[model samples]
Target: MVNIIAVDDSALNGSSTGRIHFLLADFEFTGADALHNSRMTFFFSEEQSNSCNKRGVNPMEPACPRVMISGRVKKLDTTSPEYEDNMEAFNNRHKHFKIWVQAHHFYLNELEIENIFIVAYQGGPRTIDAEDYYNAQL
Candidate 1:
């Protein structure tokens, strides 16, 4: 799985070396609305960054070994019957999955989210409004 995804230090550009730990944290899905387009709030301090830092990433830079990834699912814009059906199916699973991210030198920025899904699980929780996600101020 690691081979399929890219792990680099460019994602932690703004972050500096901080306390690092290895731990597991639960991330929930926010339906459509998000604060500053944040998928999830990563408590990196709770997780150990050593194991995932095989790239010898700078400790002074920000990096996370494991973090849950999420994003806003776009709604169907087409009117075709087939597309409508597909959209229905998509909505069923819209925000009910958990994607575990193993980032080496990545941040939550747009360019670095492509590899946040080394591992994923379906049927976790339904979508929630953005107002409910305010607590996760990532």
Candidate 2:
């Protein structure tokens, strides 16, 4: 199981590299010694266009935003070729199960996280009362 210890969304604008923005989440995995206290950074962008848009649909509207994951976790070696392959596979899975936002809540598959702060460049950041979305089963 995975327990989210903390989430940092303050750097939504500050953590940008060119057009992409990222959110960092801290997690602790139980029932395993190797994956205790791991950190994952989820990369996303407001400017990203949806590639799966139909002919009449506007591609500018963010439909199923693409998210990428990269981090320093104990279970994987960041510098290894296998790590790149694994991350690619993980990201490919998300293409079908995309990260979506609703009412300031971020959902990935069955996990619904309400503490994430979402900000768009056109407006201010919308936030919710901080609450832990923990004990999520893998």
| Local distance difference test values of all predictions, in order | 0.29, 0.33
Q: Give the residue spans of candidate 1 off by over 4 A.
A: 1-32, 35-72, 78-81, 88-113, 119-138
| Best prediction by lDDT | 2
lDDT of 2 by residue, 1-138 (tens): 343322222222333112111122223122132236344434454334443353343433444233433333333345766444433343343443225322333212111233445443334544433242233222
What is every candidate's alpha-carbon RMSD to the true fold? 17.2, 16.1
Q: Number of clashing pairs, model 2?
A: 0
Model 2's alpha-carbon lDDT is: 0.33
Span of 10 residues, lowest total lDDT, candidate 1: 1-10
**TM per model?**
0.21, 0.24
